[model samples]
Target: MMLKLRVDNQEIEAREGKTLLQACLDNQIYVPNLCYLEDMESPSASCRMCFVEIEGTPQPVPSCTVQVKNDMVVKTDTPAVRQLQRTALRLLLSVHDVDCKNCHANKKCELQNIAKFLKVGLKPKRLERYLKETLIDETHPFLIHYPNRCVLCGKCVHICRGKHGESVLTFARRGFDTIISTYSATDESSLTCGDCDTCVKACPVGALAVKESS
Candidate 1:
């Protein structure tokens, strides 16, 4: 059933069970997000973007994790929401390579899009810049994994699991050491493309991509 929700005082029709993020997009409202994929068993909320202010809530919440409720009041651009998003984005940029000039993702990149949406600089200023850049893994015949550009969103992991009934990509380590890799980071033979580009296409950032030379 279609239900009406109030977003920034604009009423929009959204189906029940749709995440606030999805509904906002459907209604042409922008909500900055990187880790959100529509069909997934779990909401990673990894990127820490997509915050929206809800009335009566103590603070802004991740719209990707919030289901649309009838008469729900959502403010997507509240000052508190902007503050949280800016902080989260700054941290993401700290470790990222920030080499957009020639990067494949370029204008299509979600990180770039969200950074523009929030009017936040790609370079981390107040946060200490991280110097470690994970080695680029070109093990796969068709795909490349650039850990330096990864935001640990897990979109590739979910897509691989859904399309193949098994996950080739998985999260490794914790904290600053965290990364996305195959069970065998050096095993190119384990990859079975099955004629599907689901993983590469589902990637929000350019962390995963088809080799141009493939």
Candidate 2:
């Protein structure tokens, strides 16, 4: 069955029961999303980039987690939506080091595109940028981790547990002390990881990365 929805003041249709993000993509709405990798079965809802306004709702909701309904009205690019998106982008950028000029993801990063779209201004709050030692796993031979760039979005853990049947990676500690590391005291290099790379691909902010093959 097909469902009709209003997005960005335009009427669009998509398959019923599919997620709003799927509906928007089907209709070319092009919502920016970080926690929603198209091929990944997991929906982490951590990045909050795919937020959209619905008629009669008080605040914008995550499109990736919302299901489409017939006659529903959705607003993806309204002024309020834009402002919220800008704020969200600013928050994500706040924790990240925006060294795009020299970073590997430079021109190709999704967060960079969102930053450009949001036209992020100088942050209202200032703090020291903490840089952690990058986590490297020689046992996997295909992955790299820069915890400083990680936004704690949990996409990697979701991918590992959801798609690979491996629960090797988990977040430890709490609050500002939280970091993505392997279960218990073992490191990623020592864990019997399958090296699926799903976690690397699911990361929205370049936290987990792939080493270019030589």
Best by TM-score: 1
- For model 2, residues 21-131, the per-residue Cα lDDT tens digits are 988988877887776755555477777788899999899898888888999998888888887777777776666766666566666678877766667653425554554
Runs of candidate 1 exceeding 4 Å displacement: 185-190
lDDT scores in order = 0.85, 0.72
Q: How well does candidate 2 score on lDDT at residue 124?
A: 28
**Top of the candidates by lDDT:** 1
Models 1 onward score TM values of 0.93, 0.80
TM-score of 1: 0.93
Candidate 1, residue 186: CA error in Å?
Answer: 5.5
For model 2, the superposed segments whose C-alpha errors exceed 4 Å read: 38-42, 121-142, 183-195, 211-214
